[model samples]
Target: MEVICLEDAAFYTLIETVVERIKEKLSTTEDKWIGGEEAMRKLRITSKTTLQKLRDEGKIRFSQPEKKIILYDVDSINEYLEEHAKERF
Candidate 1:
């Protein structure tokens, strides 16, 4: 077995590529994503309530009884934030 680390830029590029592929697959469907607390914090730039609200409103995506998690579709969050980011800016 081999261990792959994300300390290198190449690894990030690979992650990006994979995320793009996943995004393409998800684009054709109306799917909800489950993001980690940190990523959600970064996306919303706020506390848990707002994030939960976004999830509740179906404006973003997630599940309840939240905990520290990382099973997110990064591409979906990126797209959602990019589309709605200016509201914060």
Candidate 2:
């Protein structure tokens, strides 16, 4: 095995680069809004009624800009899932 050492400035620069790359990856994975079908898929539900119920009960955040067009907030859905997440031993 070979050991390589980095200088203080070089180590800091490497850390900053890794952090920026992680942030870029996370930002790309995040979504501000999604359609009902995509939201349902993310939540692993198949019924439209279940999705509507969640919206009706305010369990999730959504917006209806027109008579039939609705958009779900991705952040709210993630929050809901996190709130219901179970602890593992």
Candidate 3:
């Protein structure tokens, strides 16, 4: 195999470019998902059952990326809250 090397300045520039590209990609979000704990915390609830009920009733959407893991869409949770917001005088 042939060996390739970059000088100090060139290496730093390459690293900076890679980091910027990664940041840009990360900043562009399609959908954000949160775990049960975070969702409950956001909604100020202490029961996972409540979240499960929402999922069961199809009030919100969830994803099971793994066999035993679940994630809820942040936008759906926020939308649910907005839809159910109470009227204040």
lDDT of predicted model 3: 0.89
Off by over 4 Å in 1: 1-35, 63-72, 85-89
Say which prediction, candidate 1 or candidate 3, comes out ahead on TM-score: 3
Candidate 1 or 2, higher TM-score? 2
Decreasing TM-score order of the candidates: 2, 3, 1
RMSD (Å) per prediction: 12.7, 4.3, 8.6
What is the lDDT, from 0 to 100, of the residue 56 in candidate 2?
A: 97
lDDT (Cα atoms) of all candidates against the true structure: 0.65, 0.95, 0.89
Better of 2 and 3 by TM-score: 2
Error of 3 at 32 (Å): 0.2
Query: Across residues 22-84, which tens digit of lDDT does each residue of candidate 3 receive?
Result: 999989974599888888877778888888999999888899999999998999888989999
lDDT of 1: 0.65
Best by TM-score: 2
What TM-score against the true fold does each predicted structure earn? 0.40, 0.67, 0.63
Please tell me which predicted candidate would have the highest lDDT against the true structure. Answer: 2
TM-score, cand. 1 vs. native:
0.40
Return whichever of 1 and 2 wins on lDDT.
Answer: 2
Q: What is the lDDT for 70 in model 3?
A: 96
